[model samples]
Target chain A: MRRSERLVAMTDYFKENPYTHISLPFFVKWFGAAKSSISEDLDIIDAMFEQLGIGRLQTSAGAAGGVRYIPDYDMELSKEKIDEIIELLEDPQRILPGGYVYMSDLLGDLKQLRIIGKMFGAAFKAYDVDYVVTVATKGIPLAYAVADVLRVPVVIIRRDPKVTEGSTVSINYVSGSSRKIQTMVLSKRSIKENSNVILLDDFMKAGGTIHGMVSLMNEFNATVKGIGVLAEAEDDEEDRRVDDYISLLKFQEVNEREGRIQVARGNYFE
Target chain B: MRRSERLVAMTDYFKENPYTHISLPFFVKWFGAAKSSISEDLDIIDAMFEQLGIGRLQTSAGAAGGVRYIPDYDMELSKEKIDEIIELLEDPQRILPGGYVYMSDLLGDLKQLRIIGKMFGAAFKAYDVDYVVTVATKGIPLAYAVADVLRVPVVIIRRDPKVTEGSTVSINYVSGSSRKIQTMVLSKRSIKENSNVILLDDFMKAGGTIHGMVSLMNEFNATVKGIGVLAEAEDDEEDRRVDDYISLLKFQEVNEREGRIQVARGNYFE
Candidate 1:
């Protein structure tokens, strides 16, 4: 195959299997090219991805050695996307009663969330997380997206136990917003023993949900590698509780009187 | 950028934004190349993709003309993966008491599901689908995988209504396995009016859950472009009601006396 064609094929292969490794010999055999030629093609593809600030190609050496494509994003891309997302959320049309913002549109927008997933996946690309964990319903989308980019399975923890999942492990942590006792459960088989887990959610107020996720991970003998949220409330005066987390946008105080909303910077954009 | 680099960049760009179109000017600016040069680069990328059987590059002419990378799969690759999946599913260890299989492993394997999603997404890539629809909870992973490859949002339908999705449109349908009246609900805002949708699920016993999704789509003035299931029970002598659906494998029968199981060929491998 021609060099350009090889590069296109290689990139497509990597994109389809993010955070997965492909042996050099396998590619060499598939493309009917020399190992040297395959290596050169990968270098070109890797340079293109690095130049665009979107992905990375990591090479491992050994009997199981292979090239793995890691989906990543520039810090600026996160900032721009977060700004666009925050603007959409802060729109007056989205403001529902009781100072809540209607986020169904955002939730249903797979495009925006895909970008967020790629960004968040980039943040934890090196963590080697075994599973992506999230609470049911709203957090499912975010978890699914991150899992897609990271090539990891997502396990849903129900706020209440359903008959479908069989026996479950339950945890109770204080609700971040209401300070009430909120419970969550995971299927006993959903997580493996001694696994590394990444906690993800759609929103955070008092960081209680993440705390619960941390506790839940401990129960399963899994370690909490990282935490991520779509949005974090700005009133987190006691911000020392959150571990390593990246939020797309930090929620600013809502102006009920003037109907104004403010958002500045967050870890995702930086 | 050079022609080779432009091809790599374009492929990466399309992989990131599956269903969206990019204007000519956008690529021209990104590559710092003239419109004519960018046009040639796209043609090279398109032909390379077709040759590899990885995907297709669609181009349109005139004012809104641009390029789109429609996800596709090689037939041989599809067949190989399906065989592996069937072998895994057919293992006697997977057979649970009550005729149910322990599907958590298959559902939880991100690499396997990613390939499955691409194959399923390829089917509906020709159709203009805005969302992937399915009932919870096993169906969530299938719907999510399809949505990931198609780069579209997924709207989950629930068996019960009172859980957190707010106001919903409910429909009564017969679940094939249970043969009972079960209600499914879609969040009012989850789907837009007059949209095209793809229905997907992990397994189909009686096609009851898919019928529920079809009913929900009809209620929203939308259309069901395609239907797909990861596995189907062909020995299900009960009345089958679904049409135009694809399955990876069909369970023919379980010969408990002989310690054997039967599986039928599926169209996805073809």
Candidate 2:
């Protein structure tokens, strides 16, 4: 392959496989090129990703070291994305019955989820997350999106035991938002012990779900390194079960009768 | 920018934004290059994607023509993935109580999901999919995977109405596997009218969930261009509700007491 073609192939490989290490020999063997040429190609790709504030490629100079792709979005890019999310949340037409903003469209949106996922991934990328955890239903996509970029598996907690998942470890907790006692289950084998986990969800209200996830992670002997939500509702501020987390968008108020919404940037930027 | 560097940026851009068109002038403006030069860079990318089974770049002729990227995996690569999945599924350790295999690990696995997502993306690339659809829960990951590859949005159906989603269109359908009547809801604005949708899920046992999704799509007057599942259970062959679909892995049988499993390639190849 030509030098131009090699760069394209190299970028694709690294982007597809983030947080993965590939030896220089692998590239050397694949391209049938000298070590120097491979290094030049890496520098070019690394510079491009760095310049754009997307991520970076790192080289290990030792015998076993190759290159690893670390995807991250800088502070400025993150702020822009959150601002856009807040704008989307403030759409009056999105105000549903009660105080809920229509998040399914945002959750279901491919582009929207991608941005959210990337932002969350960027936030937790430094945590060395071994698994991305979330409860079943809405949070699954957000969890998967984070796991996708981090190149880690996602452990989806279920409200009910699934027949298809085999044996599971079940736990009971009071939902922070609903204030209802709920039973959630995880496959006994879903996560390995001592793994580092990042908990993510689409919405946070009183943080019953996020609190439940943190407790569940304890059962696996895994550490909850970070917590993130696509949007956090400030309704239950006094009743919130968990503190010390990041939210992309803050829902200050949603008036169904008035057809008004007050939204702002989340703690992620702060 | 030089041709080599421009090729890297263009490849990354198209890879990130598949199934979307970019005009020549847009590239010229971004890269500070001439139309002819931009065309040459696109050709370089088009060749790389074609030579590899991963994706393809197309050149549109005439006034409105620019370039579009379509990502797909080759036959050899697809086979390797399915074969690996079959091997993984065949493990007796995966057999769960009540004949359920422990797939949370596989489903939650980042590497595994990426492969499945890319393969599914390739299979349905020709569908001109407007949106990727799936019922909430386990199938969400599979749905997002396909959507990411196609550069389209994902429409997730909720098992129950969510206040945060505003008004929803709920439908009652009998789950093919459970044979129980259930209600699944979707936000009114989740999917646009007359959309070409591809329905995906993690497992298909009688495809009750998939059937529900297909029915839900009808409510929106959307077309079910294709149906893809990560795995399909052969247990309910006689009473299966839907027949026309694609599956990557086939679950031949699972013996709960004996701790045995049987898996094979799905109908995708056939």
Candidate No. with top TM-score: 2
Most DockQ-accurate candidate = 2
Clashes of each: 0, 2
Q: Estimate each model's TM-score.
A: 0.89, 0.96
Q: Give candidate 1's iRMS in Å, 1 decimal.
A: 2.6
- lDDT per residue, candidate 2, A173-231, as tens digits? 98765678999898888888899988888888888888888888888999999999888
Candidate 2 per-residue lDDT, tens place, B32-125, comes to 9999998878878888887777877878899998988888888888899889888888889887667777777888887888788888888887
Error of 2 at B204 (Å): 2.2
Model 2, runs deviating above 4 Å: none
Off by over 4 Å in 1: A60-65, A160-167, A172-183, A236-244, A254-264, B159-166, B172-176, B179-181, B254-263, B267-270
Candidate 2 lDDT for residue B101? 77
